[model samples]
Target: MQARYYTLNEARAALPVVKALMSQVQEARSEILRLRPEIWPVLQKAAHNGGNAAAGSVYSQFDKLETGVKGILKMGILVKDIDMGLIDFLSIRNGREVYLCWKHGEEDLSFWHDVNAGFGGRQPIDPEDF
Candidate 1:
């Protein structure tokens, strides 16, 4: 499918929903991290025994993480990194397609980069330029 390119205003409008979904994703990720140490032992024990019941919580958090990411993608946003909560929206700038980038803690949509440039290449959004 073709990418959905957002106009500057449209990209701004999508931020709220993206932020909410990112929150959900981050929370689920935190839970997964907290539970990470326990999983290996449980799996090792279950290897000798039958299925382990103790892993349910960790698996459920994975489910939540997947669901939250899907919600963001359903809106046509690119999920760049789950742990960092980075996402990008396709946008047109100077007649070429670039990414309008946002990280989880950012207060507003104010950065963008070339299609090939990752976060390190981020440029500030000029008011007059989309």
Candidate 2:
């Protein structure tokens, strides 16, 4: 798929929708992690003995989590870290690809970094950069 490039303003404008989807992704991710431990044991028991009643619920959670994440990815937003709620929008800066970075709970997209530079290299977005 072709990469979608967002201008700073475009990225900002998309934030509300992105934020809502990210929240759903985070919740689904958390549910998967919480159910992970129980799921394995349930699977193991079912393999040796009989069907596990809880297994169905665990699989359902996994399906929902996968669907939620896929929905976000389909929007061209890279979900860097679901637990941390870090997402990046592909953008052009100085004629090169860069990431417009936002973390969970941030009021706006105020930082960006070179494509090669991860979150550790985030720099405050300069007004002129827009």
Candidate 3:
């Protein structure tokens, strides 16, 4: 699918919904990590011996994680890091695509960076630039 670009105002307006979704993504990610070790053992057991009953719960957690991530991507927002809760919105700046960078815990979307630059390259958004 073609990428969707958000105007500055639109990006800012979407923050609340984005924040909520990111929270779900973060929770799902943490649960997945916590279940990883258990999941592998269960899978190994199932491989050798018919099936492991515990595998269903582990797979359910993975399904939720995948669904949450797909929901975010479907909105045209990039999930940069689940642990960091970092996300970006595609936007146009100076006639080219850039990222409106945001991380969890921030009160607002106040930074942006070039397409090739990551979080370290973020610059404060100038009110006039929008």
Which candidate gets the maximum lDDT versus the true structure? 1
Candidate 1 clash total?
A: 0
Tell me the lDDT of model 2 at 78: 85
TM-score of 1: 0.90
lDDT of 3 by residue, 20-116 (tens): 8777777777776777787787677666465454566656766776777777788888988878989899998888889999998899999999999
**Candidate 3 Cα RMSD after full superposition onto the native fold (Å):** 2.2
TM-score ranking, best first: 1, 3, 2
Q: List, in order, the clash count of every candidate structure.
A: 0, 0, 0
RMSD of each: 2.1, 2.4, 2.2
lDDT of 2 by residue, 39-78 (tens): 7877876764664656676667767767766766787878
> Per-prediction TM-score, please?
0.90, 0.84, 0.84
Candidate 2's C-alpha lDDT? 0.82
26-117 per-residue lDDT for model 1 (tens digits)? 99999989877878688677754654554787778889899999988988889998878999999999889999999999999999999899
Instruction: Score each candidate by Cα lDDT.
Output: 0.88, 0.82, 0.82
Error of 3 at 33 (Å): 1.5
